[model samples]
Target: MVLHTVNCPPSHPALGQCLRLLAPGDALLLLGDGVYAALAGSRAAAELAASGAALHVLDVDARAAGVLERLADGVSVCDDEGFVALTERYPRQQAWY
Candidate 1:
């Protein structure tokens, strides 16, 4: 399984590519502007939910954007240390900008 970090917003071509190529065993972490994709009622969030990959959002980023309370269901919040842990859990990582 690969750990995928998306640092851009959903409207970016990179995000669309990332979602298209993601496999069921992959994990997705939203950081930077990517955190906006997890906000409730977003079509991006719905797409993530359907991907069948584990979804995570950086807590610091989410809070900064004021979207922490609106995170989509099944999206887990994690801290800086947790990001490190994710890198450890998945031997391979793909950063989608």
Candidate 2:
């Protein structure tokens, strides 16, 4: 499974491209402004839910945005250590900035 990191807002074209390119079992890690997509009741969140990809968001970023508790179900919040672990697990990363 691929580990895909997106660091931009959901409105960005890269986010759409990333979603289109994802294969089954791929993991998506949202960082920076990308964490907005993990919020509950969002169109992006809905799309993500339908994609069947594992979803994660940076804990720090979500906290900063004041939306940690509002994150969609099945989305995980991770710290820096967890980010490193994801990198180690995937062995490869595709970063969309």
- Candidate number with greatest TM-score: 1
- How would you encode candidate 1's per-residue C-alpha lDDT over 49-69 as one tens digit per residue? 999999999999999998898
TM-score per prediction, in order, is 0.97, 0.96
lDDT of 2 by residue, 1-97 (tens): 8999998999999999989987779999999999999989999999988889999999999999876979999999999999999999998799999
Taken over the whole model, the C-alpha lDDT of each candidate is: 0.95, 0.92
TM-score of 1: 0.97
What lDDT would candidate 2 get against the real structure?
0.92
Identify the leading candidate in terms of lDDT.
Answer: 1
Runs in model 2 lying further than 4 Å from the true structure:
none
Q: Deviation in angstroms for 15 in model 2?
A: 0.5
| Backbone atom clashes (below 3 Å) for every candidate | 0, 0
Clashing residue pairs in candidate 1, if any? none
